[model samples]
Target: MREIRQIPSGSSLPDTQWQPPYYDAAPPPDPSQEDTWDVVRKIWRRKWLVMGITFGFIVAGAGTAMVMTPRYSAEVRVLIGLPDPNVANIEAVLRTILPNSETTQSEAYVISSREVARKVAYRLALDKSPEFNPALQPKEGWWHAVSPSRLLKELVALIAPKRNDSAAVPTADSAPMTEEQRLEEHIEAALLNRIEVTPLNRSHVLGISAESQEPVTAARIANTFADVYIEQQLMRKQRATDRANAWLQTRIGELQQTAHESDRAVEQYRRENGLYETKSDTVIAQQMGTLNADLVAAENAKADAQVRLAQATPRLNNPGDVDSLPSVLQSPLIATLRGQQAELERQAAELSSTYTSKHPKVRDIRAQIKDNTSKIKEEIERIVRGLRHEAKMADDRYTRITARMEQLKRQMGQSNDMTVKLRELEREAQANRTMLQTLMQRSKETVDQREIQTSNAEIISYATVPRNPSFPPVTLILVMATLVGAGTGILLALLLENLDRTFRTAEEVEEYTGLPSLALVPIVRGRSKAPGHVVKKPYSTFTGSLRMLNARLSLANENSAAPGGVMMFTSALPGEGKTRISSSFAQLMATEGQRVILLDLDWKRPNLHRMFNQPPGAGLADLLNGDITPEQAVYHDPASGAHVMFAGNVGRFPGYVAWIERLRMLLYTLSRHYDLIVLDTSPALLAPEVLHLARLVDRTVLVVKWASTPRRAVSSEIRNLYSVGGRIAGVVLSQVNPRRYRKYGYDDAGYLNPRHLVHTAG
Candidate 1:
């Protein structure tokens, strides 16, 4: 081992000269605080994408609203009181049995029925209107049968083979309709669909609303629908009445003829057997009663004649009792003679005293008494002869009556059979009359009802012209579009962030690689052309960050395995700003008046010589080949006053173990000449010697490009170095964009912004 040459004080020393440096086991890795700013950063990074998506959605919404057809709506309210006009119900009387939810719905259904639609369509000529008739106009909306998307789907379905080999079952009646009837039906259905009938509050009232392209047409459709339904109901009632009248008239005629025939049969049967009726009795029984009464009257006449004959005999025999005899009392002349005889007798007796009756003379009274006696006798004889003749006539009449009565009794028995047949015929006539009467009454009542027939439902409110269209709410569409766009954009941003598996923050590097982040080296434009800018622009944030890195590396010597002067830069991959970082680091140290040298040991692709105005030849490779000493191979940058060694003539010599001794001698000689040695090694994963070189360095600074280096690669390489006894001082984040890095949720990243940094030359 060579003796230490100008090594800075307070630098870490190797435990042994022959052995590799002892890794300090980096002070427990940073906790890597997590906060809300990380999420904000991801969103901010994609804010443009979010806005673009949201704006696109808004435009689409506006376009859709413009393309949609406008519709006007009108409603006609109707009250459905009862189910049927022909029947009386509690609803019609008390009006308390209101229509239930189901009944109300049924009424609404009827109002919106296909039949009603047909009537309204006919009235409004909906088939001719383009709004309801597709045949009259081109179909609306984006999708039609011949549209590109639909054609594509049909093409695919036609070309694509079935997954199964079985043949498809043919659908029944799958024939396509290509007729005017189909178009007419389509128009009818379209008209029906435009109208909505809803029950209002579970009552009998229905709201028949219709939508159309024109407000007047919508109102007309609703009003006409209600009017047609009511008209149809009235027509039904009238037809029902007419049918009833016709049936009743036909039935009444048939019944009247049947009654006449039955009455004729009863009369014929009665006449055949002499069964005549008076009140409730037959004619044979009446004739029998009349014959019996005539016989009694004849006997009474005979008795009266016998009595008068006896009285006349008594009166003729005794003239003094002649006045008491019936014949004498009945004969006016005889009575007068008796009275004269009595007066004559009294005159004769009273002649001596006073002349009273017939006072002509006593002699004349005696003569008149004698004449009266003779006249009384003659009257009694006349009475006896008339009595005898009357008696004889009475006896003959009585005999004739008795004989007729006996004949009537015989006829009555025969008439009893006729009475039975007659009664049967009479009952049939009565039944026909009863049915005729009933039908006649019903027919009369129906005629009366027809005059006052009314509809079951009436229109309570007629539709009026609508003021506005009822579709394509533009404001609502826009708001929804905005929400959808924002949500999709946020999701897209999150997806991109997750897909980006690079380390974006110092916290990420520390947490992933288990190493302290020494510094965040901001990216410098055209750094390749001016690699010495760390010293060239000493006040720039780029140069300031390099100083910070240098300071941190120096301070880390306390916990590192090797001296602070021998610092090497590497990364998980090439082009991670390691070379630029190492060169700038060396220049910054040189500007501080310390002896600093940067060596490009990236055997595959070294870029350090570009930092200085020098040719690329005979540098690290020459040193590794033992062809030149370290002092001879070092290239100097005149602008930054620093020394740099580029990868020279890297012709791919022996790989891993070959350069160990030469590399050590070169570092050993360089250590004596320079106060700081900055080694830019190849990507850690790409070269096996990078790990070997890491073992020999005082401190290895793992350089990870910000938002560029993969976390897995960085962590794996850091673990590999620790496993192989290599000293990793810490990780350095290179090429950071302060504007973007600010969102990375770091406290110190704010100062890295260009706004806070200097850019003037030194």
Candidate 2:
């Protein structure tokens, strides 16, 4: 069985103080709360660059809008009527059958329809318009006085009504065949393309809109369409009435002749029979009354047939057919064929109004009519045969009656003694005939009333000339464009921000390394000759920040076990200003009246020789290897009054533990002479130089390059230093941007812009 040991808390037992082999790595920074504000801060941090890019897009969009041809639009309103209840059994008829939905659909279709659209095109006379004319030019404006092409682009941008540039395209003078006429032509076609027709949903109103180079013209086109459509409707109704009246008149004439003849035949039959014109002779008089009723009915049927034939014939021939036709004449196949033919005719009419004769539809209609004529003739012949057979049957019945009457007349003459009986028979027939005549007159009046009611369709409301224009809603269009532009701009900003990968702030350094930032050193130019020493002057921002950092570090551990301990300087990689920081810190300490020693522990690449203006010679390596003494290898930095040592003549791959042990011994020997030791070690992660040196150091300072050092490299370096017994003091973020640091929630008031600094220094 395994046993567990209970160790006292906070006690440094042999095993507890052994230190884990692995470095306690700081967990990764969470980038989850990155909100819109973060993106905005980033934009502000890179304001100039972002502004330049966004402006580029705006300019590009504006330029594109400029090159495009200017256009305008107009509109009109049309109201469609529902069926009138007063006409033709309206409720019942509607319940049984209804007009095609297209009756209303055409209102919307009219916007794209060749008929209405072409009329607008013709009215504007766009067919002869010139595409490009140098004579028509833009005039000088405020934008014109700016960079080249500004004026034209600005003019094009003035699509809003308040900013319209009417003078952009010049009008041609009538004297020289003014461009106005040509312009109108162009405007005409443009208006057709810009035209829109929309039927109000679930309503009878139609909105027609059109666009052109001129706003007023766009309005005019819309109004004209309304006027034309109304005029067309009125004309169609009048034509329909004329056709109805014509057929009614022809039918009335035929009925009048038939009625007159029937009256004469009745009069002759009464005279021949010698029947008294009284209501008593029921039998023979009733027979005459029956014949009159039959004649009236036949006349009425003929009249109705004539009216129907007239209505259907004219309608079928009228290529501008109504959307809704009478149900009696409706046939799906016929309607489809006619609709196709009507469309072809309509298209033809646009090119030439006289196209009715030579159009393909006209040819097809002629063929259809020829075929229908044969069928109609055959149907008429069959109906005529049936009528003839009925006429023959009536004739045969009359013959038989006449023969029986003749025999009765002869018998009556022979039996003159039965005169009372013949007289009584005559009286009865007369009485029945009088009642029949009264009934026939009433029937005739009723039929005439029905026919007149059926023939007429009342004009409910006359089409009025429209007072307001219907198109080119500039406010709506401009608003939509602006909103679209704004949304697109925001999306573009986010996409660009996500694509950016540059390190931009001091907080990022602290967050990456889990260390407090000591200082943000600006990248200085033309300072190649400056000594690798922290400027002791309190006036410099960099030096002041360093002093602040030192004070904060010391105060943080005032009651710690060790005070004024070793501080090591290292970085993730080379060229991150680590050596400069180390030298500067040592100089800063020495200037503060504290003895400081700056050691170059980067055995692979020693830089202290250059800083001290000394040659690379026998130093720490030779001294530690027993070739020389520590006192012989140490040198003084004359500029900052600090002691320095170059790690010299050392192999690139020295044993880490052996070197650290010897280095610790040398440090312990020098601790009595120097109050502080600043070791400038090579990049910890890149090489084991810093890790080996970390064991002898009391605290470590990692140098990071702002907007250059990757977070992964810094974190890895910090972990490596810690694993080797290096106590992380803090980080020194180099090459920081004041604006970016402030944006990342830091007070960058003490920092100066690098460019401004260089300018001031120069």
Cα-based lDDT for every prediction: 0.73, 0.57
The pairs that clash in candidate 1 are 276-283
lDDT of 2: 0.57
RMSD of 1: 13.2
**Candidate 1 TM-score, C-alpha based:** 0.63
Please state every model's RMSD to the true fold in angstroms: 13.2, 35.1
lDDT of 2 by residue, 84-151 (tens): 23433322211111234575676456444545555655665545433222244456467446633454
Q: TM-score for model 2?
A: 0.56
Off by over 4 Å in 2: 1-17, 20-40, 74-108, 119-125, 131-192, 198-208, 214-227, 246-513, 522-529, 532-536, 559-563, 612-618, 622-629, 649-658, 747-762
